[model samples]
Each structure stands twice: as C-alpha cells, then as structure tokens.
Target: MILPIVAYGHPILRTIAKDIAPDYPELNQLIADMWETMYYSNGVGLAAPQINRDIRIFVVDSKQIFENMEPGEKNEYPGDEGIREVFINAHIKTLNGDDWPYNEGCLSIPKIREDVYRPEEVTLEYVDENFESKVATFTGITARVILHEYDHIEGKLFIDHIKPLKRKLLKSKLDDISKGKVKVDYRMMFAK
Candidate 1:
C-alpha cells in the first residue's frame, strides 16, 4: 500500500517521534508499505512522520541516485552504489567531515528542492527492521540521505537549514502545500 504522504505544516511533521518496540503492531506491514510508498513517489528516502506516523523510523534506497551519477562527475559520491536500508530509533552519534551543499527534495514537501549543507560523514546508531541494534558509519550520498531522514524523526525539516530570506521567499509555496494547493503526482494528506 502506498500511504498518503503528509504535506508540510502538518502537526505530525513537527512532532518528535517516539521509539517503537520489537512487538509494535504491524511493523513488517508498515515497513513494506513505506517501501511501496517511497518507490511510488520516486523518493530516495522517507520517514515515518511523512506518512503521518510519529515513530522513529525511516527508509533509504540510494541505488537510483547512484545509478544516475557518472563515474567522473564533479560531485563524486563514493560507496553509495546500490545501498538500501531501514533505520529505527536512530541516533546520530557524531557528524564528521566538512559541510557540503547538496540539492535536496522531500516527498512531504513536493516540488520544493533546495541546496542544504550537511556534514560529509555521519556515525549513526539505530535498529534495523528486525529490531537488531547496530552502529554504523555512512558517507557521501548515503550519509546525506540518512541525515535528511534523521531530521524528520527529530522534528526538523531541511528548510530550517536554509537562510531566512530563502525560506521567506518560499512561504506561499509552503502554505499552499499545507492547504493541499500543491500539485504532486503521489497521493498526499494535507493539514486540516
């Protein structure tokens, strides 16, 4: 099932998600539906908040993004080939390396893309879909995508990282998205 992604300004988007236990109801089903929803929306990553679930969970699949990048491209993203994974109850232990600017888009904030700067590498600790806890490090596009999703669980949006003037310029568009005025191919749930 492809769940309706909640648009920006929704209360759930700003709520700090809670951690789920291994026995959480319909965990597998929710994860499956999230993958379906993400693929349907052509998104590289999706968070639980985007789907109106206030849980600490997110999914990432960077294969498509990596496939489109050329080997000799100016922005060389390493170790991102065919990377796909699920993160639950994630915590960023450390954000290392220099800050790099990358154009980012979110399924919840459709048709809005912006250049957001993030650390080049991240050390994250989280549980996988099976509820097994693990600590891992990621870099390049993988890290970027993970960091973006991580922000969702923490009640933060990429727009918050942009300059105040740039955000002000996008106010109307953001408002339109909240009121279901934005046009997007995927299904969405607007704030009431």
Candidate 2:
C-alpha cells in the first residue's frame, strides 16, 4: 500500500490530528497500510498527516539501520527490527536534555537536512493497535525520529526548526519544490 505523501501547502498538514477511539473501525487495517506505505517509501518513520490524513497516528521502524548494543559498547542504539510501530494519540509528557543536536530531514519536506536541537531523551505514552496503553523511553536517533513524527500530527514542519536566516536562504528553493517546479534529490540529501 504505497500511499501518496502529501506535500507542503496542504491545509491538513497544519491541523491537529484527532485521537483514535478504541472502537474505531479500520484502525487495524489503517496501521497495516501505513507500515506498507512507510517501507515502500524507504522512510524510517511515517505520520498520518504525511499521507494527507488528519489522524494522530505514525509508524516508525529504525531496525533497518540501528541495532542495540550492550552497555558501554560503541553506538549501541536499537535498530528498526523491521517491526512497524503504530502510535495512536501519543503524548510526550517530558523531554530531557539540551546538549545533543542531530541533523534531521522529513519526507514531506524532502531533500533538505538541517541541524535541529531536540531533547536527547523523551518519555512517551500512547495506545497500541489493541487499545492497550504503553509507555516507552527513547534516546538518540530514535528519540529524534519520535519527536519529528510527533510534530507532524500537530501540523509542524522540519523547516520550522530553522533560524530566520536559513529560512530566508531556503525560501526560494522551498517555494520551487512546493510548486512542483523542481524535483528534490531525496537520496543525495538524506542518505546516511
């Protein structure tokens, strides 16, 4: 299920998503489709809003690039594990730290990477597909992805993280992209 990713300028991208109710029909199927679409697009994470839907849901699978390492081991962050995780009506109660900054990019704003400062760690609570409440703590790249996708549900863009100067410099390029006057080289911009 390769869903069409909504680009910038779409109004739905700015609206706060509604929470998924426990009895909502098609919830399960929607999650499945999102996973399929995310993998098909080669994204580490995908949000409902990215697909032009105003729903508070996103999928993330980092195992494709990261794998867990033992304590004191170098670069020990956990990988995607190829399991597509669904976060419905997620809430981040706390964000801790300020020293770490990571370069981030978004599918919606393809081919642009910027140094975005985010909490190095986060505490998140959300409901799973079966309507069960779950809480998890994440750090490093995983935390970065979580925060980025979470912003999507609230109608936020990665460009919003940039300073005024950079924004001005990128204005024309962004405009060209939004108007379909130019094609973004996503691979060159975001390849790890």
Candidate 3:
C-alpha cells in the first residue's frame, strides 16, 4: 500500500517521533508499505512522519542514487559505496568527518530541493525491521541520506539548515506546499 506522504507545515513533521517497541502492531506490514510508497514516489528515503506516523522509523536506498548517476560522471566522494537499509529508533552516536554540501530533497516537500551541508560520516544506533538493535557507521552519500531522514524523526527539516534569507525568500512557496497548492506526482496529505 502506498501511503500518502504528509506535506510540509504538517504538525506531525515538526513533532518529534516516538520510539516503537518490538511488538508494535503489524510492524512488518508497515515497513513493507513504506518501501512500496518510497519506490512509487521515486524517493531515496522516507520517514515515518512523512507518512503521518509519529514513530522513529525510516528507510533509505542510496544504492539507487549511485546506480542512476550519469555515465562518465565522476563519483564526488571517492571510495564511497552505497547502502540500502531500514532504521528504527535511530540515534546519532556521532557525526564525524568534514561537512559537505549536497542537494537534498524530501518526499514530504516535493519539488523543493536545496543545498544542505552535513557531515561526511555518521555513527548511528538503530534497530532493523526485526527489532534487533545495532550500531553502524555510514559515509558519503549514504550517510547524507540517513542524516536527512534522521532529521525527520528529530523534528527537523533540511530547510532548517539553510540561511535565514533563503528561507524567507521561500516562505510563499513553502506556504503553497502546506496549502496543497503544489503539484507533485506522489500522493501527499497537506496540513492546511
């Protein structure tokens, strides 16, 4: 099932998501539906808040980004391989390495890509779909995607990292998105 993504300005997007227990109802089904919704919406990552669920759950598939790069285009981050995984109740253990800027976008804020600066590597503690806790480190593009989704659970958005002037300029556009005035290919539920 492809769930409707919550649009920008939605209160759920700003509210911090709660951690889920292993016995959360239909856990497997929700994860499956998330994956389906993500692919259907052509997104590299999706967070629970994006689907109107206030839970610390997200899925990322950075491999698709690497694979879809144009031919002859050099990889920006050398030796950076992609990863595909799910993160549940994720906590940022550490953010190391230099900060780099990348054009980031969200399924909830469609057609609004912005350059966001993020650390090159991130150490995270999270559980998988099975609820087994694990700690792992991610780097390069993969890490950026994870951090982006991680922000969702933290009640933060990539736009928050931009300059105030930029945000001010985009005020009307952002308002349009919340009012369901923006057109997107995927289904989205606006707060207004």
Candidate 4:
C-alpha cells in the first residue's frame, strides 16, 4: 500500500491542508500506508500532503537516524534519542531556542538538499494516531523533523527557508523536478 509521493511544484504541496475528524474514512489504513511509503522512500517523515492528501496528518520515525548512526558517532542533540509517532491536526504552540542550520531534504524534492535554519525546540499540540490529543515539546533532530513535516501541512517547504540567492541557483533543478526530469528511487507523482 505504498502511495506515490507528490513531487515538487505540485499544487497540492502549496495548498494549505485541512484538518480531518476522527470519522475520516479509512483513517487507520491511510496512516499505515503512509508509514510503509515513508520507510520505502528512506524518509524520516511523510506528510499527508506529500501523498496527495491535503490533510493535517504526518508520521515521523527519527529513531532510524539514531539507530543507523556510525559506531563512534555521538549524538549532537542532548537527550534526543528519537521517536516514532503520528501527528494529526498538529499546531505549533511555540518555537523556542536559537536557530541552527541543518542540511535538510524532502521526499518531494529529491536530490536537492539545502541547509535551513530552524529553532532548536518546538512545542506543539497535536493528536496521536488514535485521535487522542496531546501536547509535547521536542528538540534537536526530532524537532527539525517535526518542523519540516509541519511545514508541509502549512503549505510550506524547507527550500522556502533558504537564502534567496541559494534558492535562485537551484531554480533549474527545481524546474526539472516539476517536469519529471529528476530521478528518484521512490515512486513519485509529478505535477507535469
């Protein structure tokens, strides 16, 4: 049940997603497919919009990043091991701490990685897979992953946080993605 990820320049990626109720059709199945698709694509997260569904839903499994780290490598972000969870109707309650630049990439925009500055910590109010509400704070790599997927629900992309000059230089590459010229291992649905 791996769904095709929507490619860059897709209108759905630009459109703000809508919130869904617990009664939304096939909720469990959809979330399951998302997880499958994410793992298949080697992504830490996948937003509903990325799958051509304009809804406030996304999944994250930062644990993979930590689990796959080199033997001698150390965790840069203190107290951040990793997490596997689902976010529904997520809303940022606060974004705190200093901004740090991290190399970021998206499943929608393959072969394009850029450094984007983002807050070190974020407090969010969201519902879990069961539709149970919860409020939590995240930091380090987990925070970055959450914020990145959050952007998808907000009709924004990581590239939007980069410098204009840098983004300009990537214009051709971006265009190639839109027209289905870029190559990716995972399945993707292009705008063109």
Q: Report the number of the highest-lDDT candidate.
A: 4
Which residue pairs clash within candidate 3?
Answer: none
Q: List the global CA lDDT of all models.
A: 0.92, 0.75, 0.92, 0.95
What is the per-residue lDDT of model 4 for residues 1-192, given as tens digits with 9 covering 90 to 100? 999999999999998999999999999999999999999999999999999999999999999998998755534778788899999999999999999999999999999999999999999999998999999999999999999999999999999999999999999999999999988888999886
Deviation from native of the Cα of residue 59 in model 4, angstroms: 0.2
> Which of candidates 1 and 2 reaches a greater TM-score?
1
Runs with alpha carbons beyond 4 Å of true place in candidate 4: none
Sliding window of 10 residues with minimal summed lDDT for model 1: 73-82
Candidate 4 least-lDDT 10 residues: 70-79
User: What are the runs in model 2 whose C-alpha is more than 4 Å off?
Assistant: 67-84, 184-192
Compared with the true structure, the alpha-carbon lDDT of candidate 4 equals 0.95
Q: Is 2 or 4 the stronger prediction by TM-score?
A: 4
RMSD of each: 1.2, 5.1, 1.1, 0.9
The per-candidate count of clashes, in order, stands at 0, 5, 0, 0
> Which residues of candidate 1, in runs, are more than 4 Å off?
none
Measured against the true structure, the TM-scores of the candidates, in listed sequence, are 0.97, 0.85, 0.96, 0.98
Q: Considering every candidate listed, which one attains the maximal TM-score?
A: 4
lDDT of 1 at 57: 97
lDDT of 2 at 28: 79
Model 2 agreement with the true structure over 40-122: per-residue lDDT tens digits: 76788989988877988998886554545444443444442333477889999889867466788777776778888887788
Reference-based lDDT, residue 138, model 3: 92
Alpha-carbon shift of residue 78 in model 2 (angstroms) = 8.7
